[model samples]
Target: MRRNPERRAALVDAAIEVLARDGARGLTFRAVDAEAGVPAGTASNYFAKRDELFTQAGGRIYERLQPDATTLAGTREGPRDAARVTELLREIVGRISAFRTGYLALLELRLEATRRPELRDVLTERVRADVEANVAHHLESGLPGDATSVRLLYLALNWLIVERLTLPGVFSEEDVRRLVADAVERVLPAVTRPDGPGPS
Candidate 1:
């Protein structure tokens, strides 16, 4: 097959939109072609199989949904405290809010993976890599989180994101902010000075 990066990317994005709007069952090549405003059979040319399309869409969603450079820079420069952690969490919430459809599609991908062992394996590796990356970032930022703490925080934040996306208005943004602050304070170790006082 010919390699066209731009066309493949457009098809993958179209798949994301279809998955988000129509669910996995509705993610067909024709649907993607329609979503992308391309002639019929275009998506099929890029993705020969449904599994390939789903996999590419999942990967694309991860790339597209990642926090921007500014957010990462802000997190890096901010004080390494609970409040800063809360701010980081807030940034996550903001991203999820902004990309609600893409995130919803991602959740669908997770559910679809349950019955497809190959897809499950691929997704497992992706999730594991994401966790490891987050752990590294936390350590690099001087955040008080070990691997376990980072994993816990990740799970908690994911749960919150899932809940918020699934049931809008179930928790206000403020509520999520408070929950993130509490989770950060609880999961992360207290920062203490060697020759001075610690957090009260």
Candidate 2:
């Protein structure tokens, strides 16, 4: 096994692209080597097995999807109201949707996880922790919505993303914006809940 961090990272990224473009079936060590433009056998030196590659790719996708300081700052400065929540959700949706290959590769990894309990456990734990963190953030940030509101948006918005990615023609960009607004309106209170952070 190799201990080259940069090389391993590049291999993982290459794996993600291969998964997105060709799915799990097409994700061979040779395929990754080819995608990375590295010599044949290079990916094998970095990844001991395909499952290792899968888990690394999943973690990398999350890394690539994370928001930066500006995006994080936007969350705190916004008004603590449903509309603000909608805007935040819209921004989040946009950010996640923008990483087309990452999301698509995630879908591929998820399918692979079904047959491999080891991969399933790793992915489930990571995703579940993420969901819990979102719920906790909603509650602590004084966001207008409750934990339930956050969960609802999580469910609806993710499906909307799937639709947008898998079938772009199904809804126009304007339609997505409207649907996001409507989801927030339906799930969150018209006025900020008394228990939540007061509107700025």
Instruction: Give the candidate number with the greatest TM-score.
Output: 2
Candidate models: Cα lDDT each: 0.82, 0.87
TM-scores of all models?
A: 0.91, 0.93
Best by lDDT: 2
Tens digits of per-residue lDDT for model 1, 1-200:
54899988988998998999999999998999999999998887877689998888878888987777887777888577667777888888778768988988988999999988877887888888889999899877786556787788888989899888889689987788888888876775464334423333
Clashing pairs counted in every model: 0, 0
- lDDT by residue (84-182, candidate 2, tens digit) is 888888899899999999999999999999998888887898788788988887788887766777888999999999999999999999999999988
Clashes of 2: 0
